[model samples]
Target: MAIKVKCFASMREYLDLSEREIGIDGIKTVADVWRSVAGGKPMPENTLCAVNQSQANEEFTVNSGDEVAFFPPVTGG
Candidate 1:
């Protein structure tokens, strides 16, 4: 299955691509998707994730049409 990924902020630079499509087998959690995309480098400790704009955890199972988003942690004054 193919998952649409959107990388933001520093994460985008590190990965060297803002958006891309990846193929994974079976149903995998959001974290699993990250690991696959990151190669050997793990997902950032403070990364925030959303599945179709809703907050998603590592254990959240992903479907073929899901929009998996990854962004750096947000901070405000």
Candidate 2:
């Protein structure tokens, strides 16, 4: 199965890319996707995730053709 990953805000800087597609075998969750793209590095704490534009947790199941996005926690004055 294949999934599209999008990194936003500081996540883009951390990952050093805005978007990319990855192929995986066997069952995988949102967290797994993050790890796969992270290249053995740990993900930032409090990072937020969404599946197909809807908020999702790390345990969220990822399916083929799904668009998963990661964002750093938002901050405001």
Candidate 3:
């Protein structure tokens, strides 16, 4: 299966990437995608995620050609 991964805001800098298409098999959930992209590095806490533009949780299952995005927690004055 192929999944599209996007990093936004501070996540882009932490991941050192903005977007990528990854090919994998037997992978499930947003957390799985995070592990794949992180390459053994720890994922930041409070990271927000979306799948296909809708908010999703870590347990959200991902399908082929699905777009998964990660964003750092938002803060404002």
Candidate 4:
């Protein structure tokens, strides 16, 4: 099984990927998903995430076939 990951805006640049599929083995929470693909880099404190389009925290459990998206907080003038 696999989880689809999407990085948006600045997060996409930071992660060097807009989208990728990751194996779900041993991945239980959204944090695990990040750890598996973050290449040892720490997640920014202001980063936000969504699971299946609904807002989720790092501790949110992720199942196989889930879509997880990460993005930096949005700002406007």
Q: Which candidate number would show the highest TM-score if scored against the true structure?
A: 4
Task: Write the residue-wise lDDT of candidate 4 on 17-47 in tens digits.
Answer: 8999999998999999999889998999999
Q: For candidate 3, write residues 22-67 as lDDT tens digits.
A: 8858669999999889878787778899999999999999999999
Question: Please, what are the lDDT tens digits per residue for candidate 2 over residues 1-72?
Answer: 589999999999998979998896663899989888888878788899999999999999999999999998
Count of backbone collisions within predicted model 4 = 0
Q: How much lDDT does each candidate structure score?
A: 0.82, 0.89, 0.90, 0.95
TM-scores of the models, in the given order? Answer: 0.84, 0.88, 0.89, 0.94
* Best candidate (score: lDDT): 4
Error of 4 at 58 (Å): 0.4
Query: In model 3, what lDDT does residue 59 have?
Result: 97
Model 3 has an lDDT value of 0.90
Superposition error at 16 for model 3 (Å): 0.4
Pairs that collide, model 3: none
Off by over 4 Å in 3: 75-77
Backbone atom clashes (below 3 Å) for every candidate: 0, 0, 0, 0
Displacement of the residue 2 alpha carbon in candidate 4, Å: 0.9
